[model samples]
Target: MEKLYDHLITHPLIYVARDAERALGFDLPVRGYYIITSGTSAHRKLAKQFPKNIFTVEAERNLDTHELLRHPQTKKYISDLKGAGIMVFKNTAMIEKTAKENHWKLLNPPARLVNRVEEKLEQVKWLREYADYLPPHEIAPLRNIMYEKKPFILQFNHAHSGQGTMLIKDRDTLDKLASAFPDREVRKTDYIAGPVFTSNNVILGEQALMGNLSYQITGLPPFTDLPFATIGNDFSLPHRLLTSTQLSQYKKMVTNIGHKLAGYGWKGLFGLDIAVSETTGRVHLIEINARQPASAIFESKLERDNKKRNVTGITCFEAHVAALMGIYIPNASLTPLSDGAQIVQRITKKRSAVADKVTEELGKLGLNIVTYENNAHNSELLRIQSKKYLMDDHEVLNNLGEKIKNLLD
Candidate 1:
């Protein structure tokens, strides 16, 4: 923690997120880490572990966090934000564009390096040099890719919380997707069949600290548009989550990716996508998220667990800020608890009803619900905060989906 401040003489970190707790945990003497978030649910509760840390920008349940910060109403915080030591964003092209437009002092990787990663083609191309761990993937025109003999998955390079992802089972969907979205530069690859996991990593220059691995809950409806949309992540159930060989292999892979990222000059949090094929018993590097992943909401919950047990747990975001500041915080990941744990789910529902009413209704049933007007979807995002591992249990998912869908009725 001391090392973080050592790098910057007077550069206070300005953390922007959807909730305050996501940005908390820098051991500041006087609220040095300012949290600029848009909203928190009743269940998406936030507690400032640090003393007197001021939470930001009066969150509206249905508003986007960054957009809220950029809104004319939030112009007051813009001045102080411009003066910060560094601006830490959640790693979207939108945020990068925001920084460029506002000319904020964002001390992450270059925007070009960061934006290139948002696309599947660029990520594959970057990691292609290190082909030992990466899955079999090819970058080319989708039209040419279709002529290959084997069944493959066509990707649009960039995706939003799994929106642009497709299983690509047949030609009909492939043609449909291409016709529907003709502009996206596509890549093709043989689908690696396995449970996909995200290893939250902190890359500090030439070094990459591999964080905890969490199984991604992908493609369940009501929570996502397609079956492939990542709705939640389960960090626990760690009993043999990966094989002995895989555990070591992927650690080395992340380290390799880290050293490679150093070449591009990125010292920040990233999610390394890995797929451990059940049939072949082999692990393969799938993709890379060059930003603070959506799975980071889990860290806020870990902070909650630490409070209950009276322990200090270092959150990835906290450590991420530290890493970017040239400090390596040991144990960036925390094991909170096991056995049917709370799976923090990020769900989106179309805006068909009053969002406040939906929140009120869900809250009445003791569901920690927060609704957001997603700029990507132009819909109300109903993030059911840690009710239970909805994906872990199909019954819960079914019941929850029916309940929310009933709201439309």
Candidate 2:
């Protein structure tokens, strides 16, 4: 582990973390940059890998505007980081206020853009100007059955996860549910409501960096399936939901939309959920995620390499270090971990015996463990807490799946 730290000290990297004070301990005097993250533990891990050169600003909590602006550390960190900082929060209002007051750079879409694109009705209006590329969708008025169609998806713009989304198969069911929750504001139907489509776009500024088509598997809900399968098998897919040509066209549309958004002060990452009709193959714009996608696919892709053990996690730290130093990442694809490298499951106290059992089993199969977390010694274990492995990709993943299945059984 010390060797790993020593290697990182010599390499250029970036650190992004929520707490800058706590992250400064792992500083390395190297030619790198950093961007302190605000919400997730994964970002914290990135910050821990490169300490000294990183800059971080804390997300102001639910305090009053005056109190948040006056916090000593908040004032200091924000004043220091200035344009290099990134802040994420659930409340759009607070995010807007804080960013304005402190002059911090937001890594997600601006609040105004989110508010504009969140409602299905507003999105429909925007898409109407480009009707040739979009599917027909009607915005239902408060508890009103605007469209006599089955299998429509109703979306609430401000909802997180899949909270404000509903799929209705028939008008009767829609009426029954709508009747049950009559308060229009609180109901899902009151928000930007629409039918679910197949295509989605992940945009950087106004350019579509990655575009994916959605498909339903046998066992999961239509929309929920993508997150589940993409989580572990990020490098593989059983079917093609969108062709290369369609994806290219989608990227153009996303770029146009993003350009329009830039006029509204949107200057970061955002996800646009678009729906394509199964029958007519027409696309419809759904809603936009103002922040990072909850699925964590971006981080997973960044950390997917296979050559170096635990490269995904380490590269994340390196990337953060680079971002903080105001270094421009010329190519993001080069930083991703290699394909087919199964993320070795982390060993905790509860999983110690299980990890040992699996380690012994794999050794018998002639698979040499490249990295293993030593839980016996406190300090060494803490240093290598999240252990990863380098293995024969096929054999290791299949064996890992088997091990998990056997343990569960």
Candidate 3:
């Protein structure tokens, strides 16, 4: 891993990416950019400031944007970077194939393992059998859950950021869902309300090197449609979102999952979502993200602001980069910084038309627009992101979200 790190300093880590610019705040000396989907106007302007190694190919939009790195256009982009180092991190068939074809060094977990973990059902099945903290859940074809009487959280077998999640309050929504997505696979889970939190862990072969926790922003009504659509994340003044036992339990759960993932050849950063029940105060597991999360960049930036050194003595960026490169990321103790919190706000495609206006208005209020897109049916649809500093007040962030929604409304 150190060899790759040293090489990347001069050779540059090639990124065949899509909306990957969101993670570039760390400045890892990455090069060979291939943004497959031309994102929103704000993001295109921001990404243009990307270092010289970037070569965007936004015209090719056939395959899903996440799968763009595997597209032929990416292959062509690599061919154009004739004399550069090839550092493949995203686990995709085209990426691995291209790397092997060029004899480039491969980072990230095995593509197969990544694909397996990305499935919502796979992790749910594992947790249902092994973990007792998650709410009672069931996975079946849409047909089976049609007559379910009690309210539950309805989700497609594969969807995120609120695209496939809903609160199944009654049969009417179910009827609508059946009519809309007759053939789609779905998961029905016990519904509980509380503060939703996200924890990020960097995993080696069988262990978590470090972890960070943040407040997950989801389903702020009017701004987003689904009851669980992800808007962004917040890390405000330090507070105990998790009890000592709950934190330990959460870490241990993540570590065990990490070990299991290691055995499956999975590596790099993984995230878990937990819903801290307002009633019982039990930290219940929701699901996992098998890749470096979009929120990591914001967390990393906050760490820099706190100026508190990680116990491992490695910066957030280094640990993440090293883990993917198959380098050892030593264990570290993390203390949640209490100075202030920052919010990463997202305006999804449903409200994409007002996205520019939102960012522009917020920019005047000291928040900077990060990135976004425009879409009707979510073709990397309009997603505008902005952040503001609060003295660790979750309410401040929530109020801001409400105000943003109202502005759009």
Which candidate achieves the best TM-score against the true structure? 3
TM-score of each: 0.75, 0.53, 0.79
Q: Summing lDDT over every window of 10 consecutive residues in candidate 1, give the lowest-scoring window.
A: 336-345
TM-score ranking, best first = 3, 1, 2
- After superposition, the stretches of candidate 1 with alpha carbons farther than 4 Å from their true spots are 1-11, 17-30, 37-75, 78-83, 91-103, 147-150, 176-185, 238-240, 307-313, 328-368, 375-380, 387-409
Per-residue lDDT of model 2, residues 300-389, tens digit only: 333433324544222333333233233344433223322222222323333433345654665554433323223431101111111132
User: Per-residue CA lDDT of candidate 3, range 70-163, in tens?
Assistant: 5566667656666544433346676677567666566666666666666667766555445566687777777667656787888776676667
TM-score of 2: 0.53
Please give the ranking of all candidate structures by lDDT, highest first, separated by commas: 1, 3, 2
**Pairs that collide, model 3:** 162-229, 236-392, 237-392, 372-383, 373-382, 373-383, 374-382
Q: After superposition, how far is residue 77 of candidate 3 from its true place, in Å?
A: 5.3
**Candidate 3: stretches off by over 4 Å:** 1-7, 28-51, 58-106, 127-129, 146-149, 175-185, 237-240, 308-315, 332-336, 339-350, 355-358, 376-406
Q: What is the lDDT of residue 290 in candidate 3?
A: 75
Q: How do the residues 1-409 of candidate 1 rate in per-residue lDDT, one tens digit apiece?
A: 4555554446666666554434544434444555556644422344344323444455455445557557654455657555674455555557667767776766666667876765677776666677657667666665455644456666776776666666677777677766766665687667777787776777754557676776676665444455666666655533336767877887888888888887778887888887777789788877788877755655545545654677645556556777676665654454343322222234345433345676677666555554543444523355555534333332234455446546533
Alpha carbon deviation, residue 300, candidate 2 (Å): 7.4
Model 1, CA-based lDDT:
0.60
lDDT of all predictions: 0.60, 0.40, 0.59
